[model samples]
Target: MSSDSRRFVSQLAHNEPVSQVFLASDKQLRPNRNGNLYLQVDLSDRSGSVNTRMWNATDNDYKAFDNGDYVHVEGATQLFQGNMQLIATRIRKARPDELDEGDFITLQSADIEKMRTRLTEILEQIQSTPLTRLAKGFLKDDAFMDKFCRAPAGMKNHHAYQGGLLEHVLSLMELVLAVAPKYPQLSQDKLLMGAFLHDAAKTDELFYDRDIGYTDAGQLLGHMVIGVSMLDEKVRQIVQQDGQPFPERLLIELKHLIISHHGEYEYGSPKLPMTLEAIVLHLLDNLDAKVASFSQLMADCPNSESNWTQYFSQIGRKLFKPEKED
Candidate 1:
């Protein structure tokens, strides 16, 4: 199919026919109640993703492609339990000639470079000598920087595309700059560094060459644990190179920010936000993630005729779409 005929996932409406190529992930072949097998997967473009099902599928169909491969899908979309899903008639590995790389990338190369430059400028603004050295240590690691820019902030929620991690961090850093000025007692440098480091280890935690998924380290330790370890490594490097002792209290506070940013135990925070800076970081992190996720849901909602989006089980409510002024 040509680009002109393509219907992106975000543009799909209820009861529309779908014939296009998409990046496939989270695939499974399972038996139904009657012992008939069906194929289940998520079909995605840069816009967003939709859950898809192919009935009466076989083992051969499941083996046709891997999780990250591009596939051609012949389907129709329908509203199922207030959410949009595709019912596929045919599915197969897409031919090389049928692919468009730009369709899958959320951010272009130029966008990522611009974000990286902004990130560097923000880090350079840090006034604390020890924290500044630590930030520079992470910046100078070419391998880590490359992965950090390419990694997604998450697998399915906010900023779940390549270069998304960088985008989220940069946005959060900007939030710190804006909010910190109003709260004069909070250290802007600490909040900025915390924002940058909070999700920095996601570069190592996730494998994002194609489909985003957890690495072995990510599954076992998660980003918070890995983040503390990463911070320690950079701190050690700074101390070894400068031939000086890093401040013990400052190091503990930085680690506290990382470990407590989740905000609660059920949310995976290892510790409560005891410090004022830690509390602010946790709230800011949550505010940014939720706003981004909600905004994406509004953009990707398929019910064009409705004033409200389809009920999202993830957030447990439907989102209202503001009427556009002419």
Candidate 2:
């Protein structure tokens, strides 16, 4: 919330006149050696996090709060045993949304229209008949296009912010288009479409909270299965209207791209990449997702850049290495 992060962090760092915050952690109540009820809150609101605690089981602050309310606590920073913590004196949830929602979440600064235009450009460049039509059907759906373009590549890790998936797709397309002119052995058309549509149902597939969370569809069907189902429906509609044959073999291959984009069965693929384009698409998709995750990690935690960088979990390994300061 535009609660001046620099000031809040500075105050906490300096142990100045107590700080106030929302976002209390949901941990079970426990008694300290002093026999006071202790509650710790993992307080964060887009700026950063602070661990805060309420002491005394019978205090007015404890009785006044039911233990999980978003409390505005007056507290000074203290090192409890070893880790950083706040010794809270007062506690209560603050007034609702003192700042706008926009201030509370991370977002891409890219032009949405330009990104949409870029996505359109990729669609225009496709020459494969079935893939081209599938791409167009998706791009033309107003509701799906809006959500897909605005949706993050993930709920976390790589492109976790709004328009993240588009950014990922755009990045992969750049590589695909560049490689097209050089590597004629690969089917550029299918590769590009595969990359663009690989995560299409992610628009409906992945769950996003303040960030994206896994929906039931996401957890159960996943984007791989969901994307295939969605495209299959669209293909049926297109055939119904025009009575066109969308190349059965190519349709299967496109389905393969969706089903196998995860690259392996355990990784979520029902089948490994069967066609040439599917293989390249899987690798390229993975390459883009990883590089982007590392890039964001470096952006978020510059201090940790020296030894190892911590990113949103999907990256698995901590990205290590700091940039040279100019």
Top lDDT model: 1
Q: Please provide, for model 2 over 1-326, each residue's C-alpha lDDT reduced to its tens digit, 9 standing for 90 to 100.
A: 45544234313442445645454443345689877677655654444445677676444444565433455667777644323456677777667764344443445355767878987987898887777777777777898888887787875557765677887888888888877678778888888887888888888877444434677878887887888888789888778766877888887888888889889877868898878888888888889887876665554453432556544355445566756679
> What is the alpha-carbon lDDT for the whole of candidate 1?
0.92
Candidate 1 TM-score, true structure as reference: 0.97
As for candidate 2, its clashing pairs are 70-93, 71-92, 71-93, 72-92, 153-165, 207-212, 207-213, 208-212, 208-213
Question: Best by TM-score, which number?
Answer: 1
TM-score of each model, in listed order: 0.97, 0.74
User: In candidate 2, where is summed lDDT lowest over 10 consecutive residues?
Assistant: 5-14
In model 2, the Cα lDDT at residue 258 comes to 85
In candidate 2, stretches whose alpha carbon ends up further than 4 angstroms from where it belongs are 1-97, 108-110, 302-318
Compose the digit string of candidate 1's lDDT tens values, residues 262-307: 9999998999999999999999999999999999999988777889
Instruction: List the lowest-lDDT window of 10 residues for candidate 1.
Output: 1-10
